[model samples]
Target: MTSAGSTGWNVVQLADIPATPWRNGGGVTRELAMWPDAGDWAWRMSVADVDKSGPFSKFDGIDRWFTVLEGAGVQLDVAGVLHRVTAGDAPLFFDGAADTGCELIDGKTRDFNLMVRRGSQPSKMVRVEGRHSETLNAMKTIAVYAHHSPARVLFDEEVLQLAHATLAWRMVTGSAAVGIAAQGALWMEIPA
Candidate 1:
């Protein structure tokens, strides 16, 4: 099952959110992702600030997402059930094997995360600002994350480009129709 725009995704840069002591009590910087399909089915990205504290552990074939890039509260706790997230809303799923924690409220914050596994399938995160079109199947893969200014993805003719926080392509087959010539902000993934 690999027709209608056959697979493509590139634009990953991470590894810069480390100092310890809760990121020196302020100014937390992150990226540390870009697995590029290798081994234990991995994919990770990070960005966090504002009263930062963390307790993230659990990966039995991962599957998770938490997005809040800016400010307006943030709180997450899986296995105990507690979620209060803001900043563009909608993208809070759990069960990455359970047991996770985080709590933040006030100013200074940025967030984006994706952990994929569970037998190399089942993955979805959405937040696209402009032009759109969809349809992909076959081992599945689609990931596009950019926020305003710098966009262009047309699967079925082959064209992958992105800017403004670039988290470009990742498609694994057939049916295309995703356009964004202006208004940015995006995140798309399919892996079931």
Candidate 2:
């Protein structure tokens, strides 16, 4: 894990992280990052491969955002409300404590997830396509996940080459614009 006080940024390859099976035995997930690095976490980011249809893990007092990255996607039944989440769809946000279960739309699907502890850490995910630049002001941390290979990210004077499914993290304060070049990516901003 990279410290928040690190000099610049940390780039992580998806393949480098070990996969852990979901408690419900419905899928496998690779946790990308977590705050505090130990004990209870305020926020967590991960990617999961949903191979079966079943109930999702329950997390009381947590808000979750799910985005389909590959395959057809999944149909989420959140407290009786159904949501069709596909690769191109905006991330679906729901209560982690809700009675939630999912059905694979076509087959196995890969999805990205962001879980934030309610009231303590409010987070947002934005989809980025092609070339884009954004200024970070009110964020304590910013993470960029490249859905398309060979993604180029420019922060300050540093350049990072991210492979498909790879991610980069930066802890920021004040204001600065980050440049991204990719076919598709997910930008997650965590409030300080």
Per-candidate Cα lDDT values, in order, are 0.62, 0.84
What's the residue-level lDDT of 25 in candidate 2? 79
lDDT of 2 by residue, 60-147 (tens): 9999999999999899999999999999898988999999989998999999999888886578887787887877776588888997
Q: In terms of TM-score, which candidate is strongest?
A: 2
Q: After superposition, how far is residue 104 of candidate 1 from its true place, in Å?
A: 2.0
Please state the error at residue 182 of candidate 2 in Å. 0.7
Please provide TM-scores, in order, for all candidate models, with all chains considered together.
0.32, 0.91
- Please give the clash total of every predicted structure, in order: 12, 0
Off by over 4 Å in 1: 1-62, 72-95, 105-117, 120-138, 148-150, 156-171, 174-189
Error of 1 at 38 (Å): 30
**Clash count, predicted structure 2:** 0
